[model samples]
Target: MEDDGRGFSFTVGSSELVDVGRDSGVWDVFVQAEENAPLARIGRLLDDVADRKEIFVYPSITLGATDVRPYYTVDNDLSLEVARQN
Candidate 1:
């Protein structure tokens, strides 16, 4: 949820959908989740990219990759979680 100072924060939820972030014209802005944990849309990422944004809608419908590992962990944890925590 940290802003990279790029004006728009990474949006995993739609401004009109999940009810996260503030409407900032072209894009919505979000802050880093206060208490990020597994199984939540924390600011975890892959290849220096956040993958959660695509999960706002069903991965299949939004053209997001569906990985059983992230949502369904052996410990029932997220494969991608807060980068700082990782």
Candidate 2:
């Protein structure tokens, strides 16, 4: 991951060290929600770095909080997804 004073960016990889290309899965990225706030999709990652060879964009901004940050999640991450969605 990297921050260029304009935004946050990063690549996606398998935590299991397996191939993420064959499946062509995408990771749903977001900005971490704070109290009384909502989660928002910033961008997504398609497959792994080798598979897509693309740079995902995540524009950074102040969420009026002191510790807000970016978040990356796979499909159906209910713990975070549900709370934010509801």
Candidate 3:
């Protein structure tokens, strides 16, 4: 997350959702996974991205738990935009 005291910004890479506000300069990025995806897989993905870039990663959460079933979701969203050549 990047901020200028008065506003906030988010940057994201491929395979994520980037949301840009028209009036506000704020942006948000997020990736949602269905219940079928495993929690370990999501952690690996976050680890892989962090290894490639200098970024902050929030923890993952388990939505529900049971003896035979479990669920999880990403708590933080990232924001990104394409770079323009000069």
Model number with the top lDDT: 2
lDDT agreement with native, every candidate: 0.31, 0.35, 0.31
Report the lDDT tens digits of candidate 2 across residue range 4-56.
67655566432321232232223345565457688866634434543221232
Q: Tell me the TM-score of each prediction against the true structure.
A: 0.18, 0.23, 0.19
Residue 63 lDDT, candidate 3, scale 0-100: 21
Model 3, range 1-86, lDDT digits (tens) per residue? 77667533445342221122131222233334447654322222445453422355334322222011112224333333222222
Residue-by-residue lDDT tens digits, candidate 1, 1-86: 88777454453532242232322112222355446833333233444434434443322121122121123233222432211110
* Top TM-score prediction, candidate number: 2
List runs of model 1 lying over 4 Å from the truth: 1-11, 14-59, 64-70, 80-86
Candidate closer to the true structure by lDDT (higher is better), 2 or 3? 2
- Determine the C-alpha RMSD for candidate 2 after optimal superposition of all C-alphas: 15.8
TM-score leaderboard ranking: 2, 3, 1
**CA error at residue 1 for candidate 1, angstroms:** 28
How displaced is residue 69 in candidate 1, in Å? Answer: 9.3
lDDT (Cα) of model 2: 0.35
